[model samples]
Target: MYWRTREELSLENRLRRSYYELLRDELDQFIMAHALKESYENFKNNNVAYPFVERKELKPRARIPKDEFSLHNSFLVIFVEDTIPQAYKKYIRFFDVNKTTKTNLLRSKTLSLGPDFDRSQKFLDSVHFYHFLKELLPVDYALLIQRDTSHAKTKHRYYLSHFHVRIDWPISEAAEDLARYLRYISKDVYEKGEKYAEDVQKKFFEYHALPDMIGGRRTAASVAAQYLRRLPFISTVYVSSSESRSLYRYCEQGVSRMVLMRLTTGEMEQVADRNNMPVRELKRFYMLDQNGRGGIFLFRVTYGHTAPAMPPEDGKLREIKPELFWITVKYQHLLPLPGIWEHPPLRVNLIYT
Candidate 1:
């Protein structure tokens, strides 16, 4: 073949570069269109992470990780939002009392609205709400705490909060129990004409059931866990334990947790044994002897049969702690393990905070 002139070759190279650039632009457009369409579908489906996907500051196009959603266990999951005391009136859909209850709430001088409602907010913030609901529901439950921003991207950064609770009860049982309690409260209000009806409603808060996804294949807790895992700092994913059968076996065999608690030295020992940890290890981990009852702690325990227990090498436990610095730093206390507290026979209740 004849050698082309350098000018010809230069022109050819320029043409090739332009062609590739045009192809790249078209490919980018195709991907962008597909992504936007997917996001719209997600929004329509009420996916919690949909609104935040398009924010420029949050580059992450929120997508649930498959591994994160691998908890196949059946449980009832409920979501509660906008239940803060200051925002409860504005966001009435959460726990709207009847007209009578409202008027009663206003006239009841015995009920201290300020401290009572503020306690509600504190209950949620400190995760005591999880324990409170677990007791009310009377089931072993796991709580996934996330900031309000995790649900949607708005002007507000972190002034509000929301959470998901996974109860060990069957969905049908949970639904029935909730309905029964609601009915009981309504009947009590009508018959007794109690002044504390408003207080009961306030403390009860409000929650809606989240059904299973994919034709009952994917659990509600799994779906919520997946979505929350997308934002590490703003979420706490339940790490399931290998020895979960112990709790189930306890349920079946009528094991006395009170006896188990009695076997331990003190409250700390009770928590430690409940978590399958030795008291000495628990004390060392929390520095209980040094810090006393009220000090900074990093206690973590896993429940459920999702994964095998893999203890980290000595001196490296902190590395695997949940990425919830915003909460852990402020709270500075151990969250009660639900399985331990939910058992009715347990005389020594775990610390709520």
Candidate 2:
């Protein structure tokens, strides 16, 4: 559905979320079955089965594996508007190159500044953005669209295009929360379930380092977290690590041995499976396995919450955790927050920048 109103957008979001959740459940089942089969095979071949063995690297870069792995590192979040800034003109090139030229340039297999958009102002539209993104990402990347055309304030409505782009495989392999932003710019694209624009090529470029290359020197997630923390609309933020910190620590006994087998042969026999982890304590295991070690979850303040000014009468309500002060105080906003708040996770990187 083409969402023209906030209510329509919210409804569509809910429906889309339901659809994606069904798909996620199916994918989870498939993964479980496949993992079980793989485990049984491993037990037959090597006399041991890993509880949650993933044969494939979740985010493989050039088909290599290492102790430390980074996921969501290749993603870039951008807010694109109809107009480009004067300073940003140098970074953008107009659509002058032919189809063959674009193909050849991408096939060069080297990083590029990508199409400069200085002259693209006149002809630029949704199609241009699609093509720009096509050339900007790899074949495996997932393009998530969130069209921000509606706002209570008229000036805020720039028909801005906010994209959460990942240069990785399907969205299913990524965090489930990201699926909420999956939207189509046009109804035709939505109905067709496919967008054709001569298929853009993949080449790592400078755009991915956005906010950082512009002297922000912070990741997209970091920038977003910083901005959202101050807003009265936001109640809390949950940040998790994305990359695997220690291979041995996160890996199952069988997987650890398997990792050892791939890396070295001598210690395979010596490695033993970790004691059976309880269901309640599998949070870290699940986090590492799902490649969701690092993720930012934002909880917004609802109407039910007390107004920003009115702190609850209870002293506990007035008291803010010292942990949360790092996030609130860092912005130099000394105003005591309302009672409605969730204590920040102790392990999270409070100062993301």
TM-score of each: 0.21, 0.23
Tens digit of lDDT per residue, candidate 2, span 71-176?
A: 2122222222122332432222212231123343456442243566332211223345434543433322122222233354332222213222222222221111
Root-mean-square deviation of each candidate, in angstroms? 25.7, 20.1
Residue lDDT tens for model 1, 295-321: 222222112211111222342322111
Lowest lDDT block of 10, candidate 1 = 251-260
Evaluated at residue 12, the lDDT of candidate 1 is: 46
Off by over 4 Å in 1: 1-131, 136-144, 148-218, 232-234, 239-353
Clashing pairs in 1: none
lDDT of 2: 0.23
List lDDT for all candidates, in order.
0.27, 0.23
Q: Please give the TM-score that candidate 1 achieves against the real structure.
A: 0.21
